[model samples]
Target chain A: MPVLRGFLWLLGFLLLGETLVTLTGLPVSAGVVGLLLLTTWLRLHGGGLGDIAAAAQPLIAVLALLIMPGVVGAFFILDALEGQWTAILAALIGGTLLSVMTTLALMRRLMGEASAPGEEAPP
Target chain B: MTALLDHLLATPLLAIALTLAAHAAGTRLLKALGAPAWCPPILAAALLLAGVLALLSIDYADYRRGAAWLMLLLGPATVALGLPLHQQMPRIIALWRPLLACLPVAVLLAAAYAVGIAWWLGAPPEILAALAPKSVTAPIALGINAQIGGPVSLMMGGLLITGVATVGFVSLGARLLGIHDERIIGLALGLNGHALGTVRAFEIGPVAGAFASLGMSLTGILSALFLPLAWRLVGA
Candidate 1:
């Protein structure tokens, strides 16, 4: 029940977040704004966000299930997709690689000065 | 046979049931195979369900309409990102300087790499828009697509493919850089892959999971704010 209540609060935050996004013309999506708001509230209130995580864990674990319907809808546009497949493949693979590499490199640099250098190999 | 399949798909329950069942089967298969990265259960489930839908002669729209309720979960799931993020606040705050510096550049690199590659390939505007947020989480990517007037289906597709590729790419990057700190690992995963990246990070350990959560949220927020503005600035 407490977990349920926490989820309700989370939903309420999502509603507010969506509303805020619509009104303010923010770049952040409703869901993301909801994330920030809930994080802020949890930070301020001294309550762990664990309950919400626990409540949502099962559904969240299967993250792909929630969006596959929308993704599969792409089948209807295969003709268009075919033309763009090269671009799509390039973008997804290259973009992810660049960002991941940059972030990891930067993180390593930070860890180098803050702690022992060369802390890469961990078991 | 067509009439029978149509009848089965008539109720919203069928969408829910089919999704759950497919995912369950996929999960079981993965478990039996020791959950290899090449065939994540979710991707397998999506493929299986899509194949099944195609076999039944049920179109995408019909399946999505029946799956509308499940779609509603996207919002809550995005909200759930806050939990893991909150837990990682301390480490994030401690490492704020580097993260703050790295985030915008990372977002820009990601957006630029995607748009440039797609544009070079002569992708149309809709595909360009869909691919723009390929590194962002699904709900956020969808939102970006809506704002940019892109194809939502394509956005979802791009997001999924990018996510699935993220686990492998980040690890490969780490190996090349000789950086195996779980923090870097998690950060790379989350920044590039979003939620799926975070999931991969969790497999590594708690520290990796926590940082990956932070990376996912931070990159999302940064890209959401800066990517469009940069998009507008460059007149692309």
Candidate 2:
């Protein structure tokens, strides 16, 4: 019953997101819109919603599994990828390294070396 | 053997069952082997599923018939991220100024480099579009891809690869730069790697995990809202 309640809440928000997207023509995922809406709701409500957390935990834990099939979907389009392997590999490897390095440098510059006040180094 | 394979594939739940089973086994195997942070369970599960599908001569379309049911859950799973983002609000707020400063620059660079490199290499427009949002999580990446006009499946491939590569790169880069701050490391991982990076961040520590979650959520929201507009503005 609790999980069902949580799911209902999630589904309701997802639907709300879908409605917003259709109405406003937002170029975003309904789930993301739902996530933002939920975050806003929680902020306005000023506390955690236990039921939502309960329902969300399992889903979040296996988030990778939820995405695997889509990854596998890549195989379905091998022809499209054949000639583009060079580009794909270059973009993936080169782009990832660039992004990671730039983000690290930026964060290090903007945030500095120290942890936040009252925050000890994580063990 | 062929008859058995056909009947098994014909079963409505076959894809879902295999996916769940493969992921579970992969998780266990990784745990048992003490696999490195970059080698996520999804990687192993993907390999397992791909091998099984190939060995059985099963079509991805057929496998997808059942797997589609599982994919439906991705929306809810993405929404679930709200809980962590909400719970970590205070920490998020504390770091908001720096994070906000870093996010747009980080997000744009992440997308730009991929799109730029691929474009420079004469990759097709479709591939470019797919690469544009590959740094974010899959749900958001797929959504952005749909709006921008690309192969959603290829986008997923890009995302998975990006996630794995970012984790490895971020970890190694952190070490090379002597950056021991978990927050910085975690944010970098999540910003570039998305979900898989978040998973690796958790392995580092709770502080890392929380920041990684925050990083991933913000990147997803920002990309979801911005990438399509950018794609359109570029007249693509």
Candidate 3:
């Protein structure tokens, strides 16, 4: 039953995402939008998505590992990257700093207080 | 027959085997260095595999053949993010207003800043377009690039670089800003770093991981909805 619920959650989310992408023409991928919608719905209803969430946790935990192959795909185009390494490095550093700053600013505003260094929030 | 044998033996399966071996070794090495949390397995794997491929003179296509299964797993892994989001739904709902407001602003700033810096540095249009989606997750970044006339391959590269850099520097940046709150640091990392940031968050603690997941999901959604409009405003 737990497995069935997990599978159903996956199926339902993918279908919902597909429908939204087909209908709305949003720039976002349907899968992502579907996840958001499912999350919202689950939260609003409460306890409904519990079984599925439980079943899905292990799968998601190692999600990063799954993308390793794609990362390895970089070898296919090493020459192209090597040629543009300078621009690539600059973009990465500059973009990352910019993102960090923007996010920090947003956090400061939202929390309305300075957070202590290395203080983990309560769960 | 010799060529075929070599191809079979030096395939992506070999690459995967090498990567996993490197990750195991790297983890132990990192732990020994007293930097357990900073042991970036992907980066280590990439470096190790690159060395193996260069030494063996094997083409990437042969390697990709076996490694492609990893890519396919990406779709399911992304879908699995739904479970975390679902579990944290209550907190997300309570914080909806602030989350929504912060998301668009964060997405726009992230995209604009990347493009702005790239243009100032006289980067090519292709590179600039790719950098525009650097802060978003790779899957969505790929979609955004396609929508806005950017090169998907370039965007993927940008996404990789961005994720690595974000993961590398997030803790340092937080400390520099005197941010002691793990939740904020985690949320900020996930919001901007995507999957890579989430990994970092998990290293910090469960609470940080939860916030990171929350921030990542909200940011992905908000960016998807608003990036197109942002492109139009810039007349791109």
Candidate 4:
């Protein structure tokens, strides 16, 4: 299928995911669940989604562009966000750093890689 | 002419145009600056857009309406994650155990860290609830927060902060930890970074991007299922 069709195919899965989220009371959003469903579908059928992948690359390349409105919408809650700024920013910082360290440690232990080398990270 | 220009500027399309231009400029600037991983392109672009809108005295709602179509595509863009996940199926299956073992602990620690620190700062329970799923992507985080009885607006703000911080700090962390493997970098970023990290993953390379997508999906699925339940049961 052409890229447009590929887009429609992805859109179709998104709709299905939305429907599932609504009907099944799934905890996650339709989009992520839909991605899971699509992956499962492709894996089951011997896995050929390169067409859609290629089609979506352009859109994904600019994914950040699509996310701005929501960030800007952060304006809506600015008043609520005021007093909590310290806590919120701190939690985010702490959570993020902790997540990286924890994941790295766990993955290192599981993969059993020696963590003793390469202090000089590439720029 | 001024009336026509003013009318055009007021439309949603202008929002889209401004965002695209800012992103392009940000991308170019990053490339010129040797594309340092710490300086997120999206953050730069968002800052630029936010600044311009502030200067122009435009409301976020108007910008959102102008860019409604783009926002709607966030779903499809997320669905597009399947493409990469599908491509990475073999590796995904092979690394299933490591993923399963590592993600739960990692996600739990993140949620705990977020909520714990916030609660210590005397933040309300709803804010704590919103912060629980901060590591997950925005869409899934929204669902997770809703389940946990969090305030939706707070969750959005928290998720954005998590994303920007993830994008900004991953490289620095890698440097300090001496972690150089692309797979590890990508996984760490996507695991914690959410969509912004996925974008960073793609920025570095396709292989990293693929792994980052996997990390992102795993984190989302796991956190969505586990965080709310754990938060309630554990009384954290």
Strongest candidate by DockQ: 2
| TM-score, candidate 3, chain B alone | 0.87
Worst 10 residues of 1 chain A by lDDT: A114-123
Off by over 4 Å in 4: A46-50, A74-77, A113-123, B1-6, B234-236
Return the TM-score for each candidate structure: 0.87, 0.89, 0.84, 0.90
lDDT of 4 by residue, B95-125 (tens): 6888778877877787788888898999988
Query: Which candidate gets the maximum TM-score versus the true structure?
Result: 4
* Cα deviation of B154, candidate 1, in Å: 2.9
The regions of model 2 sitting more than 4 angstroms off are A46-48, A114-123, B203-206
lDDT (10s digit) by residue, model 3, range B1-236: 55874766664576567656756665566667777344466666666776776677766666667667656556555666666666555555666777767767776777777788778777776667667777787777766777676666667767777777777777767767777666677788788788878767776766567778777766776777677667778775
Worst 10 residues of 2 chain A by lDDT: A114-123
Top-down TM-score ranking: 4, 2, 1, 3
DockQ of each: 0.50, 0.60, 0.48, 0.49
Please rank every candidate by DockQ, starting with the best.
2, 1, 4, 3
Query: By the lDDT metric, which is better: model 1 or model 3?
Result: 1
TM-score of chain B of each: 0.88, 0.87, 0.87, 0.91
Instruction: Flag clash pairs in model 2.
Output: none
- Each model's backbone clash number: 1, 0, 6, 1
Displacement of the residue B161 alpha carbon in candidate 3, Å:
1.0
- The digit string of per-residue lDDT tens for model 1 on B80-175 reads 767767766776687788877777777677777888888888887767877888888766665566566677767777776788788877777777
